[model samples]
Target: MNLNQLKYFLAIVKTGSFSNAADDMYISQSSMSKQIKALETELGVDLFKREHSKVYLTEIGAEFAKYAEMTIKQHNDMLLYLDEFATKKSNTIRFGSIPVVSSYGISAQIAQFTTNYKPDVNVVIDMHETNQQEVMKELFDGAIDIALIRTDYLDEVDVFDCIPYKKDIFVLVCNQNHPLSTKEAVSLNDLIKYPLSLLDTSSVIYTIVMKAFERHGIEKKTKCLTTRHKILMEILQTAPNISLLPLSLVDLTLFPHLCTVPLVEELTSDVALIKLKKRRLNKITKDFWIYWQKYFQMQ
Candidate 1:
């Protein structure tokens, strides 16, 4: 009927006498007898036959004893499995970031944080190209433990604890053979003269570049609008058009013929680490958060 009752039944069968089994289990014979009786009543079968001073198991009792042993083993194994799962969950930290921050340095910082701070903990990093609002949503929904995101698109600051990690300058990138590449610096007016390749209007980079153009009262001459950097790079390779991008995302080594020049009008955005204000962080996440705070402070 229950685990303890089944255990008493098994003991009676193993020891071959109820009194001896009760003594081995440290319970009174009367109590042990009552439990075995209750188990038999629940199963509608007699488990033992009693002689003058000894007991012998009935045919059904021997069969049920094996199942009782198996059940207890399975129960203990499940408890052990759950214990291990809880330990692993506490030691793992899930980190998320935008592509720019992941490409710049956060990936390496995560490796260093694990090696220097909590070497025993596990760190999982996820990178996506979604905007700041979606990153905030992931933090709110407990999808990620921490996120590195841009501050430019953040409309509400009260929901999260934000720490500025790096500042990225928005620059104009062009192929080395392009006419703008010959100049040391180029103005927004100069950029309008050539056909432009721009990020999608939904992107923060597009908003910043357009605002700079609006201030100078110049219409943007866009030849192509794309969200993919590979396509933008391909466009710049064949066409004499330039596109705006964050300095962090521009790897001059990868695109050997590409050159980045500072915009005449200063445009920049802060990349920050953010987490929910009230959410409790696990030990690994908290340790990495402190490491990053101290790391940026030294810089």
Candidate 2:
């Protein structure tokens, strides 16, 4: 049952001599002899029969020897396995932030984090299609480890440390060939007549755009086309539809034909690095925060 008992049995088997086994273990020959005696008594079996100074394993001893060697190997293997797993668990930092940060080549800065101890950390990017308020809510509820969301949204939600990452400009998008695209400066009234197909009602953009319409009392049948990026682009390019989306989604390389005229309005979101007020962050989390600061501050 005890490890010491099994260890002594194995040592004697390997050395084939009690004196040599005692020397290998750096213990007295008498201590080694006592351990073997204790094991033999507990198992109720004669482990070795000495004949003319030649030590040989008895039939029962040989059978128990197999179990003893296996037990000792398993004990050592378990310690090695735990050491490896502990390193992995410690290096794994469960953090999640929105694409609002990851989309802007912030991943490059995140990729630069290096630790002398672990050196590698796994940062989980949680880019969901929910509103900024909802994203912050998740961070508050411990659903997400960390979140990159508009700071304004967190005003109502109960939260903690918020590092101001950067500021993002709100851009109005329309088809390159659409009528509004040619205008010098389109007003909110100009977009009212056209059936507006903006971001989904669940998106952060939707919340901001709805507030403007409500403030102005602009009455129109706004089409909330909650579709994928590809589908939304198709609808915007083909029909007289206007929408406001994150500037990051506009890939000039892919959608060069799309026309983007600034809204000429004071509509901007303060992107922030946010985490819960109560939960404690580990070393990996701290390292990521450091990378984030450099990422937003750099050229």
Q: What overall lDDT goes with each candidate model?
A: 0.75, 0.65
Off by over 4 Å in 2: 1-85, 99-102, 114-134, 156-158, 227-231, 297-299
Q: Model 2: how far is 200 from its true place, Å?
A: 1.6
Model 1 residue 168 distance off true place after TM-score fit, in angstroms: 1.4
TM-score of each: 0.66, 0.61
**Model 1 over residues 178-267: C-alpha lDDT tens digits?**
888988888888887788888777567777777778888998867899875666877787678898888887877767778988888888
The worst-scoring run of ten residues by lDDT in candidate 1 lies at 75-84
Candidate 2 residue 46 Cα shift, in angstroms, is 70
